[model samples]
Target: MARTKIIAGNWKMNKTVAEATSLVEELKKELATFEAAAVVLCPPFTALVSVARLLQSAPRIQLGAQNLHPAPSGAFTGEISAAMLREAGCRFVIVGHSERRRYFGETDAFLREKLLAAVAAGLRPIFCVGEELPDRESGRWPAHLRSQLQGALSGLSVDALSQIVLAYEPVWAIGTGRNATPEQAEEAHALLRKELEALHGATVASKMPIQYGGSVTPRNAGELLAQPDVDGLLVGGASLDAGSFTSIVFAVQ
Candidate 1:
């Protein structure tokens, strides 16, 4: 079976509800023109309800959330829950993103609970795992990635695992106008596959999608997509622009 290429745009902290709707309107006009990767738009939580309402008429595009709180409900302050996202029309939620880890100090333990919450709420989890510049420079990134993958997803059922879309975003590359070459990205993706095989079986591991996230633009999209192991892209900056994001999506062809 061919894995569906997922092009998830993490519109982190950008765009108001109105701006998001306008962008989605632009995307709706053009997204259907390309039979490219499955397109997911992740606006800030504030825009989800509005964006979700718009997406009802434009079914080609999917809605996702940048993040979610682990609990269904509680006194978690200003955090939103997976159930709330579900009601807001989110089909997917990103967990363990480098930004969350770096800025908020989210740990693997917390991410595991978030993943479980997402799965329970019938939302797919886009689990982000990656290394920082220091880890890569020390040549310990593979080990770092493995620990994140295993340590976070250790006891998930096969069903829950299937709902996951793993995104590898090297901290050094994200939003820095730099990216891992196709070869380097492929190597990391291949290593992730190996790690999955060890945790699950080869059959299960082979079917999972491993997406690369970083400074992915139309210029490098085609080459990166051409690499056999790179199943999709968790796009950032380029995705903020409808034209550029569409170009990157078409590069999958």
Candidate 2:
């Protein structure tokens, strides 16, 4: 089966409720022309309810969460659970983003728990696996990513694994304005697919979509998506603006 292209916007730590609503409205209008790809918008937690309500009738564009806690409910202050996210109309949640790892001290073990929680809650988890610049420069990118993948996806059954959407986000490129070349993205994506195949078998791995998320923009979307192993993209800064994001969506379409 051919993997469906997913163009997801990571509005990380930006956009108020009103801003999110406006963005969603604009996306609904612009998305009408591009229905071939799955467009996901992940606004801040404060904006999920409003965004969800606004997109209640617009199913083409899905709502996602930037992060989620591993436990369903707990005294973990400042954290939201997977069930809570699902209730807010989120169909997906991003786990192990580099920012979280770098700033919040999230570890692979914690990410594994969160991935399981997201899966158990019936929410598709976009498991982010990537390497930092130093790791890449040291020729340890593959080993690092592979290790993270294994640890994060430790005990998931093949059936559970099938629901996962892997993202290959190079830490150095994210939010740095230094995007990876199409060839570079393709190489990483291909390697990621190979790793998945080793753990999940070709049949399941082939069906799983691997997305690139590192300074992706409309100008480069077409070339990036054209790569054989590049199934989709996890857009960041460019996705915050409706016009720019829609342009990227249409490019994929």
Candidate 3:
């Protein structure tokens, strides 16, 4: 089966409820005639319900969460669980974003727990795995990616793995406006496919979507989307703007 191209916006900490409504309304209108790729908006937790309601009629657009806790119910103050996210009307959830892994000291093992929780709770997870500048500079990023993938996704069965999406957002590139080159993204994506095949099998690996999430802009979106191994994108800053985000989606088509 061919993998569908997905463009998921990771709206981290931005957009008030009213602002989010306006944005999604605009997207619903602008993209109403658009039906090329799978689109998702990951607004802040406070905006999930509002955005989800707005996107209900837009079948091509899906609602996603930025982060969630591993447990179903717990006293983990300030932490949102997968169940809560589902209740908020989210069909997808981002797991192991670099910001969370770096700032919150989330280990690979910890992310594995989160991925498991998200999957078990019926929300599909866009599992992020990538490396920082130092790792890339030392030419050890591939090894790091291998270890990360093994630690986080290897234990899952093929059925669960098939329901997941993999995102490669080089740590040094996420918000710096310096995205990896098309060749670079392809190289990383191809490596991820290899890893997935080893962990599961060729059939599961072939259909898994590997998204590129860094400093993606409409200017470079076309080139990146053209990569055979780059199945989609996990857009950040640029996704906040309706025009720019729309342009990126069109780039896929």
Q: Indicate whether candidate 2 or candidate 3 has the larger lDDT.
A: 3
lDDT of 1 by residue, 62-165 (tens): 99999999988999998999989999999988999999999999999999999999999999999999999999999999999999988898988899999999
After superposition, the stretches of candidate 3 with alpha carbons farther than 4 Å from their true spots are none
Each model's TM-score?
Answer: 0.98, 0.97, 0.98
lDDT of 2 by residue, 119-173 (tens): 8899998889889999988999989988998887766788779889999999999
Model-by-model lDDT, in order?
0.91, 0.90, 0.93
Candidate 1: clashing pairs of residues:
none
The true-versus-predicted C-alpha distance at residue 25 of model 1, in Å, is 0.5
Error of 2 at 153 (Å): 1.2
Better of 1 and 2 by lDDT: 1
Task: List the candidate numbers ranked by lDDT, top first.
Answer: 3, 1, 2
Lowest summed-lDDT stretch of 10 residues in model 1?
30-39
Local error of candidate 2 at residue 158 (angstroms): 1.1
Q: Which ten residues in a row have the lowest lDDT in candidate 3?
A: 154-163
Query: Considering only N, C-alpha and C atoms within 3 Å, which residue pairs clash in candidate 2?
Result: none
